[model samples]
Every structure is written in C-alpha cells, then in structure tokens.
Target: MPTTPRPVKTVLASVTAAVLLAAAAATPAHAQSPPLRDLADQQGLRMGAAVASHLLDDADYRRTAATEFNSVTHENDLKWESVQPQPGQYSWSGADRLVEFAEQNGQQIHGHTLVWHSQLPSWVENGSFTPAELTQVMEDHIDTTMGRYRGQIQTWDVVNEPIGDDAQFRNSVFHRVLGEDFIAQSLHMARAADPEATLFINDYNIDGINAKSDAYYELAQDLLAQGAPLDGIGLQGHLISGQLPQDIQQNIQRFADLGLEVMITELDIRMTMPVTQQKLEQQARDYTQVMDACLAVSGCSGVTVWGVTDAHSWVPDHFTGEGAALPIDDDYEAKPAYWSIHEALGGDGQNGPDDPGPGEPGTGTCEVAYDFTSQWGQGAVVEVTVHNGSGSAVQDWSLTWERPSGEQISSAWNSLIQQSGTTVTAGPVEWNRSIAPGGQVSFGFQTTHAGAPSVPGGFSLGSESCTIR
Candidate 1:
C-alpha cells in the first residue's frame, strides 16, 4: 500500500525546497537567489556500500569504494563458512581481507553479524548442541570474533533478523534451546568481548513505522531497562518503490528516545523489475524522505546505504525482482538517484537546489557531515573536509578558523587538527599527501556552540571558507 502521493505531486514539493532554504540565509539577495546548493549541505551520515568477496580483490573496485564511501559492510563477512567453516577450525581469511582493506583506505568497518540463523554452519544448527554446549559455543564465538577487531571496527550487528514480521521472536535453534534469554546473552557476551565497539540489535521491519516495528520498539525498551548492554539500534531499511512509510522520521526519532544512537544501517531501497524514469524519481524521493528523517533526529548518528553502486548491489541477488537499489549505477556513474541523495543532503544539482561545479574550494567540493541529533550549543563539532579535487596528492595541509567571541572550545574527535582562539587551526596533519590526481581526505571537530554565532573557515588543499548562512 503506497502512502505518499505520486511523482507528479512531489515535483511541486521540490520547488518549495529551494525557496525555503533561500529564505533562511541572512542576505535577502542570496535568499532570493533562486535556490542553490551542491553535494555539501548534508550532515555527518556515513554514506556507504556493501562489498562482495569477489570484488574485494580488485584494485579498481577497492579504489572506487574508497572514493564513494566512508564505511563498508561485507555481505557475508561473518557467515558460518568464513567464521567457523569446520567444527572447530574457524577461518578468518575473508573477514581478514575486508578488515585490512578498510583499514588501509582509512575507512570505517562494520562486522556484519555474530549470529543469524540463515547463514550458520549445519554443525551449529542440527548438530547435537545441548543447552550448555550452545551457550559455550555462543560465548566463544562472540569473544573470539568481536575481540579480534576490538579497537578498529566501529560497530557490530550483534543479532540480525531475529524477530518475525508478526512481532514474535522467530523460532530458531537459539530460541528453541536457549529461549528469549538468547538475545540478552548474545549482546552481553558481545559487550564483554570488545566493550568499545558499539553493539546493535538489527532488523528490517523496524525501519519504518507499523505494527511490526511497534513490537520491535516495545521489545527493545524492555531489553534496555533490563540493562542489556545495547548502545545502538540498526534499522535495515530495505524499502521498495511505491511503498515508503510516511512517518519514517518520527519512527527513527522514537527509537532515539530510548537514549541510544540509531543508525540507518543496511539501507537499500529496492524496486520491481524494468526500472523507469518515473520509478527512479520515486526512488530518489524515497531516499530524500529517509535522509530527511535522519537529519531531523538528534540521537541519530548517521545513515549508511547498503551499497554504493548498483554494479555491486545485493538487491538483484537477494530480492525476487529488484535492481538499481544503489545511488551509483553499474558503471560507477552517478544516477538520478545519486543526485536525489545529494539533494536530500543539501546538494545543488537537479537533485538539489543549486548545484556547484567541479573543484569549487570551501564550497565543500569534497566533505563529510555529522548529523548528530543535538547541536554543539556552547559546544561545536569542527570538521575538516580535504579534497585533492583533480590531479593532486595531498601529502600535507593546514586549516585556520575565525570563531566568534565568548565561545570556549571543548573536546574534539579524530585529533588530526589543532585549535586556536577566535581562530581554530588544523592540519599540516600527515597524509600520504597524494590524492591520486583527484583523491580526498576528511576529519571532524566536536565543539560547543554559543549564541554569539559563527560559521567555520580556513580550508586547504584548495579552498578557503564555506558559504555560511
């Protein structure tokens, strides 16, 4: 059942987007400047893609992935064959390559899962596991795998797709033998292993609002109150065309209300076979709606698309009849959907209000965003986005920002940058310094904001100040 109006209806909605943003800027002239933006306006959402084992070995594929995403999720990184292929002889070949590849490129990594009934080994399935045997096996698996990547990986989808659409816990081996306590123990064991990596209970139906998700919410709340070591919730938003839920933003926010960071992980909007312009437009709108929901929620940390390019997307393989779930098409070219994402991210192209041309300095030609639910009130997070643009390798760089009075700088993350009063500084920070003719680099700043008002400045590798409103 489709909830939103058809494409013809949203075209008008697009018109209002540019106008509203224009009015917000201080200058009446700029405000009335017919709506302008580019791929720069979005906040700190880690746009990403899924990678297959076959593609991981290609130099070209790896390079493209580095450019397109900040984070990468391996589809079968922890499947039974890769994790515990033999009864007791676990192999880390595939997962190792993924972790190594991600690290070398300075990208974030997410361990796909520790437990999923679908991909487990047959031994773990019907192979004689008494209650004690299962519990030990579970603990050993969690401690071994999670502990291996303790400080490096960002998060883990601890337990995936455990609940049915009907809201009852799915009756799997873990449940039949270990029962509901299985969920709690799994998370607890995971926390005990890494303690640093964020642990999430992930699933698909919990993405949009509905009876199915309502059940997810209630269950999650109970888990939290009982002191389950849960730090995040993952909404695997596998949305399809003509079927986006309208109250998605509110739904994401509701989960954040439970005092945990929420992420749009494993997000890939699917569609029926034989795609079309009208269908593509609808897909863009769906992406916009999801990104907008993430932008509005405070505790919402970021959003990660399931795959970066359609050539490597899993939609075609997994779904009965769906393709074009990614923003980039098979050839790694940008699609209408890509522009739509940029638009939702405050881009200036057709997908946005006013798109910028190539190599525009300080215009955020290359950048990263942090869409934290709350602002840096009296505290601000300063982020530096560095780009090689085209034909440059940045071995070294520098940044200096002029701040307003009465604003004290607080703590910072990714300490590659340095700060100075009214004028904060970063860089001369080390890098391979070669952007490979057109490569890019970026880092973030978390500072306290003040009423005095300020817009960030001091960029290098080619730009100066960003267009601050």
Candidate 2:
C-alpha cells in the first residue's frame, strides 16, 4: 500500500497539467493517434490501470482513466480491509464511487480480492475460530461482497496469494485452519454468488516459468479435474526493470493450454531511485516485453498496470531505493513505457515467436553442475547449477547430494537448504524457484570440511537421477 498521501492542492495541480497535455495531444493532426483504450479495443485487449477512488474527484484524473483505459480496478478501495474493516459491518462508499465512475466511463470492473492475508481487519486475523467457524466466516464475506456486485464486476480474484514465496501453500489463517481445501471452497462460494463472473486465483512472482508458477499450474489442473469452477489464473506482473523473465510467453501459454484465461494483473516495473534516461529506456523495454507476451497469447485477456502514475505508486514506499514505476510520471506526463505499450497494441501483435504451444510432460530428466569456486584450510565455497530438461516446468524442485562425512554447509544463498546427516537438500527460493525447460538456476554455499573435501556423489533433481557435470 502507498503510505504517503498527497495534498489535495498538489493532486489538483498535477491533474490540471495532465488535462492540458491531453488537450494538446488531441489536435486534428493527432486525432488519428488513438488513446490506449482505442488501440487496445482494436486488438481485443483491455488496457487498464488501478485507480484511486479519491483521485477520481479531479476532472483530469477521471478523464485520463475514462479515455485511456477500458477497464478499472480499485487500487485499495475493494480490499478486505477497505470494504469490511469491521466484522459484519460493511463500508461501500469508496468502492461505490469507483464502480459508478467505471460504469459512466463504459469500463469493466475487475474486483480486486475477496480473500487476502494482508489488509485484513484485526478481528478476522485475531479471532479465535474453529475450522468450521472460520470457513463460514470466509464464505459469508465472499457471498456478501460478491453478491453485492454480482454481474457488475466482470472478474473477481477469489483467492489471492494462497501460495507463498517458498513455493508452498502459505500458512495463512484460512490455510492453517481449513488447509488447501480453503481455496476450493472459496472458489465454489464465489461461483455460487455470481455464475456469470470469471473467478481467478491471483498471486505475484508467478509471471514467468518458475516453481511458484508450477504450483499454480498443478493447482489449476487439480481444481479443473475435481470440477471446481476455476475460470482463470492472474499473474501479478509486478516486475523490476532489466529482470523481465525470459520465458514469460511460454509460462502464459502453458497456463492457457489448461483451458483457462490468463491475465497480467497488477503490472508495474520499478527501478532504483534517481531515474535516468537509460533506466527509463530499459523500463520501456520491460513494459514492451510484458505487453508483447500478453498479446502473443490468445487466452491472455489484458494487461493492467498497478497504478495510474508514479505519484501514487506503491513501489517507493514498500521497496527502499525504488520508485518511478508507472507509465505516467509524478507530474502526470506520459513516460516512454506508456508509448511503448500504445505502439505495441496498435501495431501487429506478432512481436513474439510463433507459439510452439505447451510442452509435454518431461521424463524428469535433469543435470546438476557442481564446482568449487574457492577453497580454504577448513572452509570452501561451492556453486551448483540445476538444469531442467524435463520438457515441462518442474514444480517444487528439490536437489539432493551427499557431502563428505564431516563437511557441513554453514551458509547458503538463493535457495532454502537443510542438511540431514550426509545428505543436503536444496529447494528454490522465490526468484529462482522455477527453471524453464533447457534453463538452469544457480546457488552457492560455503561449507566447512574435514581434511581435503572430495567431490560428493548421488546428486539428483527430485526423484530423477541427474548426470553430474
């Protein structure tokens, strides 16, 4: 959430400047140059932005959202904390304003979230309730919230961030009490409330092929197999500049292959502070890559940037030394990234390679590359790389190898690791969790050894024996 609040005067000034700029851009010569919404509509894409309800009071802010986007998501107004701060007491003033604005503008509403571990009122988090009681409470909230909007909101993020960065179900209250069944139950309740609405499981860090995404892939399949009303998967594409995932298109295609709609929800690319021309250019490229990936996939419905402008971006407050995330700057000027997306949407959508479609399940074939980067009298550093040739993405990958009898790992990075006796198990962290087909991720560890350390054997990726290199 954005912590710093802007004064009404400053916000008005920025909005005024934006309106003037928009007027200038709409001259007769530039009339053919459509706003993002017009371009997106041509390609059957919905260009959207997460909007602040209060900002809509300003004519320019409202105009910007109405003209540039065909979809609107309330940045915080629709969250659990915002709508239902007190148990059984609902507040809809903020959300209602946004909904009305969207309606007047002919825009689709994407319901932010019905259930999330964050922004939850203290009562819900601290209340001592049994599994059955908690389940009822959650279902009631879903019913009330969704039933209110019903067909107005086109899509709903029924479950948010159920999977943690460790590539496992988060130990949220719902999970701790009701277990994984909570997800299925929530989806079922949402479905019953509004049969016409599309329900999605939304999470961050699953934008590309990785362990976290693999978990979602498997979960989507399981839910469908059991006849759960799971309509889509929302990949919160909150990214960092210069680090766009290489296989993002493949990841989206894989999810689409499961016969589910995929959306790049909450998209933003933040960079380190003191923005430069070079950094902005890279940001444009990153935005282009994400939009291109979505365009290339038929099932990828749209791309929604997290916020309307850098003035209210959550990046600076949450991430130290990071800001300038959105396509619009603090002064309400469109940045290069905004134009990049506009151009991509208006031009041919063939920016990506011909889709090879989804890959088949691999034979669990893998390779492990181990090397001693440095060695000392009693301590040594080793770097290990795990390659995935499984043809399909591997979920929750675990690497195991035997270390010398007395050699023990003291410190490790880039992985969750533990040693039991002579065997060491390493699993992917949030960033390096998923290894794309024919791709690899590397992690290093420092260890203390007894005498001269000898190369350890019995290396394996999951149950498949890896050919050591």
Estimated TM-score for each candidate: 0.68, 0.70
Off by over 4 Å in 2: 1-32, 347-469
- The C-alpha RMSD of each candidate to the native structure, in angstroms, is 13.7, 25.9
User: Model 2: how far is 64 from its true place, Å?
Assistant: 1.2
lDDT at position 173, candidate 1: 90
**Residue 364 displacement (Å), model 2:** 69
Residue range with the least summed lDDT across 10 consecutive positions in model 2: 349-358
Global lDDT of each candidate: 0.62, 0.77
Question: Mind sharing the TM-score for model 2?
Answer: 0.70
Error of 1 at 395 (Å): 26
Steric overlap count per candidate: 36, 3
